[model samples]
Target: MHNISKNNEKPEYGWFVKDLIVAFSIIGFIGIIFVSLGIFLTDLLQLFFIFAGIFIIVLFLWPGLGMAVMNIILDWKDDDITDSFDEMKRLEIPIILDIGCGTGRTAMKIVKALENGGHLYGIDIYNKMAISGNDLERVRKNAQLEGVAEKTTFQYGTATEIPFEDESFDIVNVSSVLHEIHDREDQKKAIKEIYRVLKPSGTVYIGEWNSRSAQLIGYMGIFCFVFKPSKYWEYLLKESNLTLMNVEEKGGFVLFTAQK
Candidate 1:
């Protein structure tokens, strides 16, 4: 007769080592409280035990959990490349424009990624935020450090009136900047300018507000009901000359990429 072994017991340690350390720390804390109240411990021993336990717990917990969080923060700080650029690279290294390029994250990222010769231009409406808040100088410094500063240029300009001839850029990307403007007419005009300046078959990308949390959704619902339908942006893009390529709704932001 063959006997079956029960493997049902949760292995006390594997994936959640940090959680285990935290749990142990909590238990140790409670135990320390009992010892202090009941046993009448001396001040030195009490302090030593409490500190040592806390230190040990943090030591065990920090590596995995802390490293994961650090990696996420670093990724957020770095430039992101969407898969749509694959075709852009395959065809030619086209001149790229970043509208509302606060601190030049996307602009820097694209410039660094390009091979051979390609020009990059960035424009921002807010002078202070574009230069100071976005760490534009840092981007410039990095570009110079990487020997690509000559290929990049930045200007203070509004998206509605881009200082360029028609059909100027091969690709334009605007990230996380629409809802803040709050002027529908100006927003439409800005988009039209983007379309006008983009060469035929060029790509335009827009990332904008896609959600309001449950707490804020009530306000959004009321505003939508009174003024416009839900997903007004989706319809706006439909009416534009560009063809929508993708809509990614994640991390409380929507990424919309289109081709002219």
Candidate 2:
């Protein structure tokens, strides 16, 4: 097993931290400007400016800081993925596929949880904007550092056109990926591909953000509009002919477990 010494090295989750810092800086600058303007104004107008400045800062910073806490400090994604794995029935020598396996974050965790002998194949288009240094080589290196390289494989692939035979995977995992497909038609095609690649009675786990939830509104603010509601995913699963087995929600995220 390939392993990296745990001296000072750590997994890089991406530019989220840097992005949050930038956002905070901008918010602070704008807030300062508004407060400065209020000092020169008169009566109710001054009060309005001061309050509006504080409100704007709080409004956006609440979500931005919350995201930092959940993603960076708490590493909630790992916990959520592990919870999904715990729900699955044990399969001997399972053949697993991780869609949109960015930087091997989710894929490595899944492989580590496999007590039985099995291999995990991860595929991603490696969209750089999705995550800092998101590429096949980075994922492979991460697997090696995590000491799961021998049981894991990373490659370039898309959800709409999975480069594998029908019924190839015993289990499929999609985490916060389908929403990136954007177009509803392409999203449906991706679901169909997932269904096609699963063996009979195979299980699929899909994790997505619920746009309609209060958690999302609190954490993402107006940006939550980017995600679809949980009902949309249920409809997609039904449309793809996959039987929805269970739906789990936590921290504004939803996990849909289905069977093929």
Per-candidate clash tally: 1, 0
Model 2, runs deviating above 4 Å: 1-8, 15-28, 43-62, 76-80, 86-89
TM-score versus the correct structure, for each prediction: 0.60, 0.86
| Residue lDDT tens for model 1, 1-260 | 11122543211101212343345445545554554554455678766666665554344333333433433543455436554466456545679888877655556667766777688888776544223334445445545654567999877777889899999898888875665566888878988998999999898878764445332232233222222222666777888888888776644346677888
Clashing pairs in 1: 103-134
TM-score of 2: 0.86
Model 2, range 1-260, lDDT digits (tens) per residue?
22454774555556544465457657856776887899999999999999888777666665566565556643543463665665343787889999999887778878888887799999999887677778787887787778788999888899999989999999999998999999999999999999999999899999998999997777667667878999999898888889999898987789999999
Show pairs that collide, candidate 2. none
Give the winner by TM-score. Answer: 2
